[model samples]
Target: MTTPRLTPHAYVLAVPDLTRTTAYFEHVLGFSRLWNDGDNWQALGRDGVRVMLGRCPDAIPPAELGDHSYFAYVEVSDLDGFHAEIAAKGALLGFPPRDQPWGRREMAVATPDGHRMMFANPIRA
Candidate 1:
Protein backbone atom coordinates (compact mmCIF):
# COMPACT_ATOMS: atom_id res chain seq x y z
CA MET A 1 0.00 0.00 0.00
CA THR A 2 1.18 3.52 -0.83
CA THR A 3 0.42 6.64 1.12
CA PRO A 4 -1.56 9.21 -0.79
CA ARG A 5 0.03 12.55 -1.56
CA LEU A 6 -1.35 15.75 -0.14
CA THR A 7 -1.95 18.65 -2.45
CA PRO A 8 -2.37 22.02 -0.79
CA HIS A 9 -5.12 23.99 -2.43
CA ALA A 10 -5.23 26.95 -0.11
CA TYR A 11 -3.32 28.53 2.75
CA VAL A 12 -5.02 30.26 5.65
CA LEU A 13 -3.28 33.24 7.15
CA ALA A 14 -4.26 35.29 10.18
CA VAL A 15 -3.60 38.96 9.79
CA PRO A 16 -4.11 41.91 12.06
CA ASP A 17 -5.93 43.95 9.43
CA LEU A 18 -7.82 42.14 6.71
CA THR A 19 -8.23 45.13 4.46
CA ARG A 20 -4.58 46.06 4.57
CA THR A 21 -3.43 42.48 4.26
CA THR A 22 -5.63 41.88 1.23
CA ALA A 23 -4.33 45.08 -0.28
CA TYR A 24 -0.77 43.77 -0.09
CA PHE A 25 -1.76 40.57 -1.86
CA GLU A 26 -3.79 42.47 -4.42
CA HIS A 27 -1.84 45.64 -5.10
CA VAL A 28 1.67 44.36 -4.58
CA LEU A 29 1.62 40.65 -5.37
CA GLY A 30 -0.97 40.90 -8.16
CA PHE A 31 -3.47 38.47 -6.64
CA SER A 32 -7.14 38.99 -7.40
CA ARG A 33 -9.68 38.99 -4.61
CA LEU A 34 -11.85 35.91 -5.08
CA TRP A 35 -14.24 36.23 -2.14
CA ASN A 36 -14.82 38.08 1.07
CA ASP A 37 -17.00 37.94 4.13
CA GLY A 38 -17.13 41.58 5.10
CA ASP A 39 -14.26 42.40 7.52
CA ASN A 40 -13.68 38.93 8.88
CA TRP A 41 -12.35 36.93 5.93
CA GLN A 42 -11.13 37.32 2.39
CA ALA A 43 -9.70 35.05 -0.28
CA LEU A 44 -7.07 36.01 -2.81
CA GLY A 45 -5.88 34.04 -5.79
CA ARG A 46 -3.11 34.31 -8.37
CA ASP A 47 -2.31 31.79 -11.06
CA GLY A 48 -3.48 28.57 -9.35
CA VAL A 49 -2.62 29.65 -5.81
CA ARG A 50 -5.29 30.59 -3.33
CA VAL A 51 -4.79 32.31 -0.01
CA MET A 52 -7.42 32.80 2.66
CA LEU A 53 -6.98 35.69 5.03
CA GLY A 54 -8.75 35.89 8.35
CA ARG A 55 -8.77 38.91 10.58
CA CYS A 56 -7.14 38.18 13.91
CA PRO A 57 -6.36 41.37 15.75
CA ASP A 58 -5.39 39.75 19.03
CA ALA A 59 -2.98 37.15 17.72
CA ILE A 60 0.75 37.74 17.58
CA PRO A 61 1.72 39.36 14.31
CA PRO A 62 3.75 37.28 11.83
CA ALA A 63 6.56 39.80 12.19
CA GLU A 64 7.23 38.34 15.61
CA LEU A 65 7.24 34.70 14.52
CA GLY A 66 10.68 34.69 12.89
CA ASP A 67 11.17 31.52 10.81
CA HIS A 68 7.88 30.14 12.07
CA SER A 69 6.05 32.69 9.95
CA TYR A 70 6.98 31.02 6.68
CA PHE A 71 3.90 29.44 5.18
CA ALA A 72 4.30 28.80 1.47
CA TYR A 73 6.73 27.34 -1.07
CA VAL A 74 5.50 27.79 -4.62
CA GLU A 75 6.94 26.46 -7.86
CA VAL A 76 6.76 28.78 -10.83
CA SER A 77 7.93 29.13 -14.41
CA ASP A 78 9.85 32.11 -15.72
CA LEU A 79 11.03 33.10 -12.26
CA ASP A 80 13.22 35.89 -13.58
CA GLY A 81 10.30 37.52 -15.31
CA PHE A 82 8.15 37.11 -12.24
CA HIS A 83 10.91 38.53 -10.08
CA ALA A 84 11.28 41.57 -12.30
CA GLU A 85 7.54 42.15 -12.33
CA ILE A 86 7.12 41.82 -8.57
CA ALA A 87 10.17 43.94 -7.91
CA ALA A 88 8.79 46.68 -10.15
CA LYS A 89 5.52 46.45 -8.25
CA GLY A 90 7.43 46.99 -5.01
CA ALA A 91 7.13 43.52 -3.53
CA LEU A 92 9.25 43.20 -0.37
CA LEU A 93 11.93 40.96 -1.86
CA GLY A 94 14.09 38.64 0.21
CA PHE A 95 16.77 37.95 -2.37
CA PRO A 96 17.12 37.99 -6.13
CA PRO A 97 16.63 34.68 -7.89
CA ARG A 98 19.74 32.54 -7.99
CA ASP A 99 20.63 29.01 -9.02
CA GLN A 100 21.22 26.65 -6.16
CA PRO A 101 23.41 23.55 -5.91
CA TRP A 102 20.27 21.54 -5.42
CA GLY A 103 19.34 22.13 -9.09
CA ARG A 104 16.80 24.91 -8.78
CA ARG A 105 16.59 28.65 -8.97
CA GLU A 106 14.91 30.20 -5.93
CA MET A 107 13.75 33.53 -4.66
CA ALA A 108 11.99 34.65 -1.53
CA VAL A 109 9.85 37.50 -0.26
CA ALA A 110 7.90 38.39 2.83
CA THR A 111 4.41 39.72 3.09
CA PRO A 112 3.65 42.90 5.01
CA ASP A 113 2.90 40.85 8.11
CA GLY A 114 6.26 39.06 7.67
CA HIS A 115 4.87 35.76 6.41
CA ARG A 116 7.56 34.40 4.12
CA MET A 117 7.18 32.54 0.82
CA MET A 118 9.74 30.87 -1.40
CA PHE A 119 9.31 30.55 -5.13
CA ALA A 120 11.41 28.23 -7.22
CA ASN A 121 11.97 27.03 -10.77
CA PRO A 122 13.96 24.01 -11.82
CA ILE A 123 17.30 24.95 -13.28
CA ARG A 124 17.51 23.50 -16.72
CA ALA A 125 20.74 22.49 -18.34
Candidate 2:
Protein backbone atom coordinates (compact mmCIF):
# COMPACT_ATOMS: atom_id res chain seq x y z
CA MET A 1 0.00 0.00 0.00
CA THR A 2 1.18 3.50 -0.86
CA THR A 3 0.99 6.00 1.97
CA PRO A 4 -0.70 9.26 1.05
CA ARG A 5 1.64 12.22 0.77
CA LEU A 6 0.99 15.47 2.58
CA THR A 7 2.43 18.97 2.73
CA PRO A 8 1.78 21.98 4.96
CA HIS A 9 1.39 25.51 3.62
CA ALA A 10 0.65 28.00 6.40
CA TYR A 11 -0.75 28.63 9.88
CA VAL A 12 -2.96 31.48 11.12
CA LEU A 13 -2.45 32.98 14.57
CA ALA A 14 -4.29 35.77 16.32
CA VAL A 15 -1.94 38.20 17.99
CA PRO A 16 -2.52 41.38 19.92
CA ASP A 17 0.54 43.03 18.40
CA LEU A 18 1.50 42.23 14.85
CA THR A 19 4.64 44.30 14.99
CA ARG A 20 5.90 42.50 18.08
CA THR A 21 5.05 39.09 16.72
CA THR A 22 6.63 39.82 13.35
CA ALA A 23 9.76 41.13 14.96
CA TYR A 24 9.96 38.10 17.24
CA PHE A 25 9.79 35.72 14.31
CA GLU A 26 12.46 37.63 12.45
CA HIS A 27 14.94 38.45 15.18
CA VAL A 28 14.61 35.19 17.07
CA LEU A 29 13.67 32.46 14.64
CA GLY A 30 15.61 33.96 11.74
CA PHE A 31 12.43 34.12 9.66
CA SER A 32 12.29 36.74 6.95
CA ARG A 33 9.11 38.68 6.40
CA LEU A 34 7.57 37.58 3.15
CA TRP A 35 4.90 40.32 3.05
CA ASN A 36 2.30 42.15 5.08
CA ASP A 37 -1.11 42.41 3.42
CA GLY A 38 -2.35 45.27 5.55
CA ASP A 39 -4.54 45.33 8.64
CA ASN A 40 -2.93 42.60 10.82
CA TRP A 41 -2.34 40.02 8.11
CA GLN A 42 1.37 39.31 7.90
CA ALA A 43 3.01 36.38 6.14
CA LEU A 44 6.23 35.19 7.73
CA GLY A 45 8.73 32.34 7.98
CA ARG A 46 10.56 30.61 5.15
CA ASP A 47 11.02 27.41 3.15
CA GLY A 48 7.37 26.28 3.17
CA VAL A 49 6.81 27.02 6.87
CA ARG A 50 4.71 30.15 6.99
CA VAL A 51 3.12 31.82 10.02
CA MET A 52 0.30 34.31 9.59
CA LEU A 53 -0.45 36.74 12.39
CA GLY A 54 -3.87 38.38 12.48
CA ARG A 55 -4.61 41.30 14.74
CA CYS A 56 -7.36 40.72 17.28
CA PRO A 57 -9.41 43.46 18.79
CA ASP A 58 -9.61 41.88 22.24
CA ALA A 59 -7.33 39.17 23.54
CA ILE A 60 -7.27 36.06 21.39
CA PRO A 61 -10.59 34.26 21.46
CA PRO A 62 -10.73 31.00 23.37
CA ALA A 63 -11.47 29.14 20.16
CA GLU A 64 -8.12 30.03 18.64
CA LEU A 65 -6.29 28.22 21.41
CA GLY A 66 -7.86 24.88 20.77
CA ASP A 67 -7.07 21.80 22.90
CA HIS A 68 -3.30 22.25 23.07
CA SER A 69 -3.26 22.00 19.32
CA TYR A 70 -0.01 22.95 17.63
CA PHE A 71 0.10 24.62 14.23
CA ALA A 72 2.89 22.45 12.85
CA TYR A 73 6.00 20.48 13.65
CA VAL A 74 9.06 21.95 11.96
CA GLU A 75 11.68 19.35 11.03
CA VAL A 76 15.22 20.51 11.58
CA SER A 77 18.46 18.73 10.89
CA ASP A 78 19.65 19.67 14.36
CA LEU A 79 17.03 19.88 17.08
CA ASP A 80 19.60 19.97 19.87
CA GLY A 81 21.46 22.86 18.23
CA PHE A 82 18.29 24.85 17.65
CA HIS A 83 17.24 24.15 21.22
CA ALA A 84 20.41 25.79 22.47
CA GLU A 85 19.98 28.72 20.09
CA ILE A 86 16.42 29.43 21.20
CA ALA A 87 17.36 29.07 24.85
CA ALA A 88 20.14 31.61 24.46
CA LYS A 89 17.76 33.91 22.61
CA GLY A 90 15.32 33.73 25.53
CA ALA A 91 12.46 31.81 24.02
CA LEU A 92 9.31 32.01 26.16
CA LEU A 93 9.21 28.28 26.77
CA GLY A 94 12.35 26.37 25.96
CA PHE A 95 13.21 22.82 26.90
CA PRO A 96 15.84 20.21 26.30
CA PRO A 97 15.35 17.78 23.41
CA ARG A 98 14.00 14.32 24.12
CA ASP A 99 12.94 11.28 22.19
CA GLN A 100 9.27 10.48 22.49
CA PRO A 101 7.39 7.26 22.21
CA TRP A 102 5.89 8.46 18.94
CA GLY A 103 9.32 8.01 17.37
CA ARG A 104 10.72 11.51 17.18
CA ARG A 105 13.25 13.69 18.95
CA GLU A 106 11.77 17.09 19.68
CA MET A 107 12.05 20.32 21.60
CA ALA A 108 9.00 22.51 22.12
CA VAL A 109 8.91 26.22 22.74
CA ALA A 110 6.35 28.99 22.82
CA THR A 111 6.27 32.60 21.75
CA PRO A 112 5.47 35.42 24.14
CA ASP A 113 1.95 35.40 22.74
CA GLY A 114 1.55 31.70 23.60
CA HIS A 115 1.94 30.25 20.13
CA ARG A 116 3.61 26.89 20.54
CA MET A 117 6.27 26.02 18.01
CA MET A 118 7.97 22.66 17.94
CA PHE A 119 11.14 21.58 16.20
CA ALA A 120 11.82 17.91 15.79
CA ASN A 121 13.54 15.16 13.83
CA PRO A 122 12.18 11.74 12.96
CA ILE A 123 13.73 8.84 14.84
CA ARG A 124 14.85 5.90 12.79
CA ALA A 125 15.01 2.36 14.13
Candidate 3:
Protein backbone atom coordinates (compact mmCIF):
# COMPACT_ATOMS: atom_id res chain seq x y z
CA MET A 1 0.00 0.00 0.00
CA THR A 2 1.15 3.52 -0.74
CA THR A 3 0.36 6.62 1.28
CA PRO A 4 -1.65 9.33 -0.36
CA ARG A 5 -0.32 12.84 -0.67
CA LEU A 6 -2.03 15.70 1.08
CA THR A 7 -1.56 19.36 0.35
CA PRO A 8 -2.75 22.57 1.89
CA HIS A 9 -5.21 24.38 -0.33
CA ALA A 10 -6.22 27.46 1.63
CA TYR A 11 -6.86 28.99 5.01
CA VAL A 12 -10.21 30.49 5.91
CA LEU A 13 -10.09 33.29 8.47
CA ALA A 14 -13.13 34.66 10.25
CA VAL A 15 -13.08 38.42 10.07
CA PRO A 16 -15.46 41.01 11.41
CA ASP A 17 -15.05 43.25 8.38
CA LEU A 18 -14.31 41.46 5.17
CA THR A 19 -13.58 44.52 3.06
CA ARG A 20 -10.96 45.96 5.36
CA THR A 21 -9.39 42.61 6.04
CA THR A 22 -9.25 41.81 2.37
CA ALA A 23 -7.53 45.09 1.63
CA TYR A 24 -4.97 44.46 4.35
CA PHE A 25 -4.05 41.12 2.86
CA GLU A 26 -3.80 42.62 -0.58
CA HIS A 27 -1.84 45.77 0.20
CA VAL A 28 0.13 44.81 3.25
CA LEU A 29 0.89 41.19 2.56
CA GLY A 30 1.14 41.52 -1.22
CA PHE A 31 -1.63 39.00 -1.83
CA SER A 32 -3.59 39.46 -5.02
CA ARG A 33 -7.35 39.84 -4.77
CA LEU A 34 -8.70 36.64 -6.21
CA TRP A 35 -12.47 36.90 -5.83
CA ASN A 36 -15.29 37.75 -3.54
CA ASP A 37 -18.94 36.84 -3.15
CA GLY A 38 -19.67 40.60 -2.76
CA ASP A 39 -21.20 40.04 0.61
CA ASN A 40 -19.25 38.16 3.23
CA TRP A 41 -16.57 36.13 1.55
CA GLN A 42 -13.35 37.12 -0.19
CA ALA A 43 -10.28 35.26 -1.36
CA LEU A 44 -6.67 36.37 -1.75
CA GLY A 45 -3.56 34.64 -2.96
CA ARG A 46 0.18 35.12 -3.48
CA ASP A 47 2.79 32.69 -4.69
CA GLY A 48 0.50 29.68 -4.38
CA VAL A 49 -0.61 30.72 -0.89
CA ARG A 50 -4.31 31.31 -0.67
CA VAL A 51 -6.32 32.80 2.15
CA MET A 52 -10.06 33.15 2.43
CA LEU A 53 -11.60 35.90 4.49
CA GLY A 54 -15.14 35.37 5.72
CA ARG A 55 -17.20 37.89 7.63
CA CYS A 56 -18.23 36.44 10.97
CA PRO A 57 -18.98 38.83 13.77
CA ASP A 58 -18.95 36.11 16.38
CA ALA A 59 -15.91 34.29 15.11
CA ILE A 60 -13.76 35.36 18.01
CA PRO A 61 -15.66 35.24 21.25
CA PRO A 62 -15.24 38.30 23.46
CA ALA A 63 -13.42 36.29 26.09
CA GLU A 64 -10.83 34.99 23.68
CA LEU A 65 -9.87 38.46 22.50
CA GLY A 66 -7.45 38.80 25.40
CA ASP A 67 -5.66 35.62 24.41
CA HIS A 68 -4.29 34.02 21.27
CA SER A 69 -7.54 32.79 19.77
CA TYR A 70 -6.44 32.30 16.18
CA PHE A 71 -3.15 32.10 14.30
CA ALA A 72 -1.75 30.86 10.98
CA TYR A 73 1.77 29.66 10.30
CA VAL A 74 2.81 29.63 6.64
CA GLU A 75 5.97 28.27 5.12
CA VAL A 76 7.77 30.54 2.69
CA SER A 77 10.65 29.92 0.32
CA ASP A 78 12.43 33.23 0.87
CA LEU A 79 11.85 34.25 4.42
CA ASP A 80 14.29 37.17 4.47
CA GLY A 81 13.17 38.65 1.19
CA PHE A 82 9.54 38.26 2.11
CA HIS A 83 10.13 39.87 5.47
CA ALA A 84 11.88 42.83 3.87
CA GLU A 85 9.08 43.29 1.36
CA ILE A 86 6.40 43.16 4.01
CA ALA A 87 8.29 45.68 6.11
CA ALA A 88 8.76 47.99 3.16
CA LYS A 89 5.01 47.95 2.63
CA GLY A 90 4.58 49.36 6.14
CA ALA A 91 2.89 46.28 7.54
CA LEU A 92 2.82 46.07 11.30
CA LEU A 93 5.33 43.32 11.88
CA GLY A 94 4.98 41.64 15.23
CA PHE A 95 8.67 40.80 15.22
CA PRO A 96 11.63 40.49 12.93
CA PRO A 97 12.69 37.14 11.58
CA ARG A 98 14.54 35.00 14.07
CA ASP A 99 16.01 31.53 13.93
CA GLN A 100 14.13 29.14 16.16
CA PRO A 101 15.44 26.12 17.96
CA TRP A 102 13.03 24.06 15.87
CA GLY A 103 15.25 24.82 12.82
CA ARG A 104 12.99 27.41 11.25
CA ARG A 105 13.47 31.09 10.58
CA GLU A 106 10.18 32.79 11.36
CA MET A 107 8.52 36.17 11.51
CA ALA A 108 5.11 37.18 12.83
CA VAL A 109 2.54 39.87 12.20
CA ALA A 110 -0.91 40.72 13.45
CA THR A 111 -3.89 41.44 11.29
CA PRO A 112 -6.24 44.34 11.90
CA ASP A 113 -8.75 41.93 13.43
CA GLY A 114 -6.04 40.61 15.73
CA HIS A 115 -5.33 37.34 14.01
CA ARG A 116 -1.69 36.34 14.30
CA MET A 117 0.11 35.33 11.11
CA MET A 118 3.52 33.73 11.13
CA PHE A 119 5.75 33.13 8.12
CA ALA A 120 8.61 30.69 8.34
CA ASN A 121 11.20 28.76 6.35
CA PRO A 122 13.44 25.93 7.32
CA ILE A 123 16.85 27.16 8.49
CA ARG A 124 19.62 25.96 6.27
CA ALA A 125 22.56 24.21 7.88
Candidate 4:
Protein backbone atom coordinates (compact mmCIF):
# COMPACT_ATOMS: atom_id res chain seq x y z
CA MET A 1 0.00 0.00 0.00
CA THR A 2 1.20 3.51 -0.77
CA THR A 3 0.61 6.51 1.46
CA PRO A 4 -1.32 9.45 0.06
CA ARG A 5 0.14 12.93 0.04
CA LEU A 6 -1.52 15.54 2.22
CA THR A 7 -2.20 19.13 1.31
CA PRO A 8 -3.94 22.13 2.81
CA HIS A 9 -7.21 22.91 1.02
CA ALA A 10 -8.81 25.60 3.10
CA TYR A 11 -9.00 27.43 6.41
CA VAL A 12 -12.23 28.38 8.14
CA LEU A 13 -12.63 31.59 10.10
CA ALA A 14 -15.41 32.66 12.43
CA VAL A 15 -16.79 36.05 11.54
CA PRO A 16 -19.43 38.34 13.02
CA ASP A 17 -20.96 39.38 9.71
CA LEU A 18 -20.74 36.68 7.09
CA THR A 19 -21.91 38.83 4.17
CA ARG A 20 -19.54 41.69 4.92
CA THR A 21 -16.57 39.45 5.52
CA THR A 22 -17.27 37.46 2.39
CA ALA A 23 -17.42 40.65 0.36
CA TYR A 24 -14.10 41.77 1.79
CA PHE A 25 -12.45 38.57 0.66
CA GLU A 26 -14.00 38.88 -2.75
CA HIS A 27 -13.37 42.55 -3.42
CA VAL A 28 -10.44 43.60 -1.27
CA LEU A 29 -8.37 40.48 -1.50
CA GLY A 30 -9.35 39.50 -5.05
CA PHE A 31 -10.65 36.11 -3.99
CA SER A 32 -13.41 34.49 -6.00
CA ARG A 33 -16.53 33.41 -4.15
CA LEU A 34 -16.66 29.65 -4.59
CA TRP A 35 -19.82 28.83 -2.66
CA ASN A 36 -22.10 29.94 0.13
CA ASP A 37 -24.74 28.38 2.38
CA GLY A 38 -26.81 31.50 1.82
CA ASP A 39 -26.58 32.42 5.50
CA ASN A 40 -23.83 31.17 7.77
CA TRP A 41 -21.06 29.88 5.57
CA GLN A 42 -19.11 31.00 2.53
CA ALA A 43 -16.04 29.75 0.71
CA LEU A 44 -13.58 31.80 -1.34
CA GLY A 45 -10.51 31.12 -3.38
CA ARG A 46 -7.65 33.16 -4.81
CA ASP A 47 -4.94 31.61 -6.92
CA GLY A 48 -4.58 28.34 -4.96
CA VAL A 49 -5.53 29.72 -1.56
CA ARG A 50 -8.94 28.91 -0.17
CA VAL A 51 -10.77 30.31 2.85
CA MET A 52 -14.11 29.59 4.44
CA LEU A 53 -16.01 32.11 6.49
CA GLY A 54 -18.55 31.02 9.09
CA ARG A 55 -21.10 33.16 10.80
CA CYS A 56 -20.26 32.74 14.47
CA PRO A 57 -20.15 35.91 16.49
CA ASP A 58 -20.03 33.94 19.73
CA ALA A 59 -16.99 31.98 18.61
CA ILE A 60 -14.89 35.14 18.62
CA PRO A 61 -14.46 36.34 22.17
CA PRO A 62 -15.30 39.92 23.13
CA ALA A 63 -12.09 40.64 25.05
CA GLU A 64 -9.98 39.96 21.98
CA LEU A 65 -11.66 42.69 20.01
CA GLY A 66 -10.36 44.49 16.89
CA ASP A 67 -7.34 42.76 15.31
CA HIS A 68 -7.22 39.59 17.36
CA SER A 69 -4.10 37.52 17.90
CA TYR A 70 -5.01 35.13 15.10
CA PHE A 71 -3.43 35.89 11.74
CA ALA A 72 -3.17 34.23 8.34
CA TYR A 73 0.12 34.36 6.50
CA VAL A 74 -0.01 34.14 2.70
CA GLU A 75 3.03 33.58 0.52
CA VAL A 76 3.14 35.63 -2.65
CA SER A 77 5.55 35.76 -5.56
CA ASP A 78 5.56 39.54 -5.79
CA LEU A 79 5.16 41.17 -2.41
CA ASP A 80 5.46 44.75 -3.62
CA GLY A 81 3.07 44.30 -6.52
CA PHE A 82 0.55 42.54 -4.33
CA HIS A 83 0.78 45.31 -1.74
CA ALA A 84 0.27 47.96 -4.39
CA GLU A 85 -2.77 46.22 -5.80
CA ILE A 86 -4.48 45.77 -2.45
CA ALA A 87 -3.57 49.27 -1.28
CA ALA A 88 -5.17 50.70 -4.41
CA LYS A 89 -8.29 48.77 -3.50
CA GLY A 90 -8.41 50.64 -0.18
CA ALA A 91 -7.12 47.86 2.00
CA LEU A 92 -6.54 48.71 5.66
CA LEU A 93 -2.81 48.05 5.67
CA GLY A 94 -1.18 47.59 9.06
CA PHE A 95 2.14 48.62 7.55
CA PRO A 96 3.99 48.99 4.28
CA PRO A 97 6.09 46.17 2.85
CA ARG A 98 9.52 45.75 4.42
CA ASP A 99 12.24 43.12 4.44
CA GLN A 100 12.19 40.92 7.51
CA PRO A 101 15.22 39.46 9.29
CA TRP A 102 13.98 36.02 8.31
CA GLY A 103 14.63 36.86 4.64
CA ARG A 104 11.09 37.63 3.62
CA ARG A 105 9.40 40.84 2.54
CA GLU A 106 6.10 41.23 4.38
CA MET A 107 3.10 43.51 4.80
CA ALA A 108 0.07 43.13 7.04
CA VAL A 109 -3.54 44.15 6.66
CA ALA A 110 -6.79 43.69 8.50
CA THR A 111 -10.03 42.45 7.02
CA PRO A 112 -13.36 44.09 7.65
CA ASP A 113 -14.05 41.56 10.40
CA GLY A 114 -10.70 42.25 12.06
CA HIS A 115 -8.80 39.22 10.83
CA ARG A 116 -5.14 40.04 10.39
CA MET A 117 -3.62 38.79 7.12
CA MET A 118 0.10 38.92 6.40
CA PHE A 119 1.35 38.77 2.83
CA ALA A 120 4.98 37.82 2.30
CA ASN A 121 7.52 36.78 -0.29
CA PRO A 122 11.10 35.60 -0.12
CA ILE A 123 13.80 38.25 -0.34
CA ARG A 124 15.67 37.26 -3.44
CA ALA A 125 19.45 37.33 -3.42
Taking all chains together, each candidate's TM-score versus the true structure is 0.93, 0.80, 0.86, 0.88
Residues 42-101 of candidate 4: C-alpha lDDT, one tens digit per residue: 999999899998899777642266556445788999989988898898887889899999
Cα lDDT tens digits, model 1, 7-124, are: 8689999999898889999998889999999899999999999999999999999989988998998998889998998999889998989999999999998998889999999998
Task: Look at candidate 4 and tell me the lDDT of residue 120.
Answer: 91
- Top lDDT: which candidate number? 1
Which of the two candidates, 3 or 4, achieves a greater TM-score against the reference?
A: 4
Which parts of model 1 are misplaced by more than 4 Å?
Answer: 1-7
Candidate 3: minimum summed lDDT over ten consecutive residues — where? 61-70
lDDT (10s digit) by residue, model 3, range 75-125:
899999999998998887879899999899999887878787788999998
Question: Which parts of model 4 have CA positions greater than 4 angstroms off?
Answer: 1-4, 61-68
Clash list (residue pairs), candidate 2: none
Candidate 2 ranges with C-alpha deviation above 4 Å? 1-7, 59-66
Candidate rank order under TM-score:
1, 4, 3, 2
Indicate whether candidate 1 or candidate 2 has the larger lDDT.
Answer: 1
Residue 89, candidate 3: alpha-carbon lDDT: 83
- Candidate number that wins on lDDT, 1 or 4: 1
lDDT of 1: 0.92
List the pairs of residues colliding in candidate 1.
none
Clashing pairs in 4: none
Q: Best candidate per TM-score, number?
A: 1
